[model samples]
Target: MNAKELHDKTPDQLREELSNLKKESFNLRFQQATGQLENPAQIKIARRAAARVKTVLNQKAAAAAATE
Candidate 1:
């Protein structure tokens, strides 16, 4: 997922996405530890996606604070 896409989602949606990404990241790490991971790159992708969602969520929170 991209930052732009994440920015378009509501905070609740972003939180859900972040949670899912984290779960996937954890699973990927487990797979890697067991040496059964097919694509190790996915771990990095999921991490970055979670970060993007977080960034967007922070931005939204900041914007809301500013408006208030």
Candidate 2:
């Protein structure tokens, strides 16, 4: 998912997306630990995606706070 898509989602949807990304990241780490990970780059990609979602979420929160 891209930042544009994330930015369009409501906070609840963004939270759900973040949760799924975290689960994927955890599973990737477990696979790497067992030496069964075929693509180590996936871990990095997932981490970044999670970070992107977080950045969008924070931006949304800041915008809301500024309006209040």
Candidate 3:
């Protein structure tokens, strides 16, 4: 997903997306181990996507905390 899309998601949704991305990453790794992965680049993509979600989530949390 793109940054714009990620930023648009609410905190709860972002967390859910993060969970799904991590699971996908794990599955990709398993596929790689078994030599069944059609695309090795998927691992990197999933990792970066997860990181983007996390970065945005943190940003939102900090912004909320700062207002208080």
Candidate 4:
């Protein structure tokens, strides 16, 4: 997911996306721990996606606060 796409979503949608990303990250870690993971790169990808979502959320919050 790109930051531009995330920026288009409302905060509520972004939160849900973040939740899903975190869950995926957890599952990826579990798979890696079990030696069942085909690609360890997935773990890093999920983490970065979650961070992107978080960054967008923070930017939205800051923009809202600035306007108030």
Candidate 5:
């Protein structure tokens, strides 16, 4: 998903997405180890997507904490 779509998702949803992405990343790694992975660059893209979700989640948490 794109940054705009990621930003629009609720925190809980973002967390869920992050978890799923991590799982996918793990699977991708396994595929690579077995020499079955196609488009190895997908690993990097998945990692970046997870990072984006995390960054947004962190920003939201910080904002919430600041308000209280």
Candidate 6:
């Protein structure tokens, strides 16, 4: 959801969330292709959510590397 929320989650949880988002995105694309999509905006939302999770994950990795 938000950066603060994502930052509070463990890496494993973040990965799970990212995986779910990707699945949702794929489903949305399929629906769109078949002209059955209810909301086209959902595709964009899912993409941005995935990107946010990725950004937080990268930040955590970078911080861990710095500490090491």
**Candidate 3 — which residues are off by over 4 angstroms?**
none
What would the TM-score be for candidate 3 when compared with the true structure? 0.96
User: What is the C-alpha local distance difference test score of each model?
Assistant: 0.92, 0.96, 0.95, 0.96, 0.93, 0.98
Regions of model 6 farther than 4 Å from truth: none
Model 4 worst lDDT window (10 residues): 26-35
Candidate 6 lDDT, tens digit per residue, 1-68?
Answer: 88999999999999999999999999999999999999999999999999999999999999999999
Q: For each candidate, C-alpha RMSD in Å?
A: 0.6, 0.5, 0.6, 0.4, 0.7, 0.4
For each candidate, give its TM-score against the true structure.
0.96, 0.97, 0.96, 0.98, 0.94, 0.98
lDDT (tens digit, per residue) of candidate 5 on 1-68 = 88889888899999999999999999999999999998999999999998989999998899889999
Q: By how many angstroms RMSD does model 2 differ from the true structure?
A: 0.5
Give lDDT tens digits, candidate 4, residues 1-68: 89989999999999999999999999999999999999999999999999999999999999999999
Each candidate structure's count of clashing pairs: 0, 0, 0, 0, 0, 0
Clashes of 4: 0
Displacement of residue 24 (Cα, Å) in model 1 is 0.2
- Cα displacement (angstroms), candidate 2, residue 56, comes to 0.4
Model 2 has how many clashing residue pairs?
0
Clashing pairs in 6: none
After aligning candidate 5 to the native by TM-score, how far in Å is the CA of 20 from where it should be? 0.5
Per-residue lDDT of 1-68 in model 1, one digit per residue for the tens?
Answer: 77778878999999999999999999999999999999989999999988888899999999999999
- Model 2, 1-68: lDDT tens per residue? 88888888999999999999999999999999999999999999999999999999999999999999
Task: Give the range where candidate 5 is weakest over 10 consecutive residues by summed lDDT.
Answer: 1-10
Residue 3 lDDT (model 6) = 90
Off by over 4 Å in 5: none
Candidates 2 and 5, the one with greater lDDT? 2
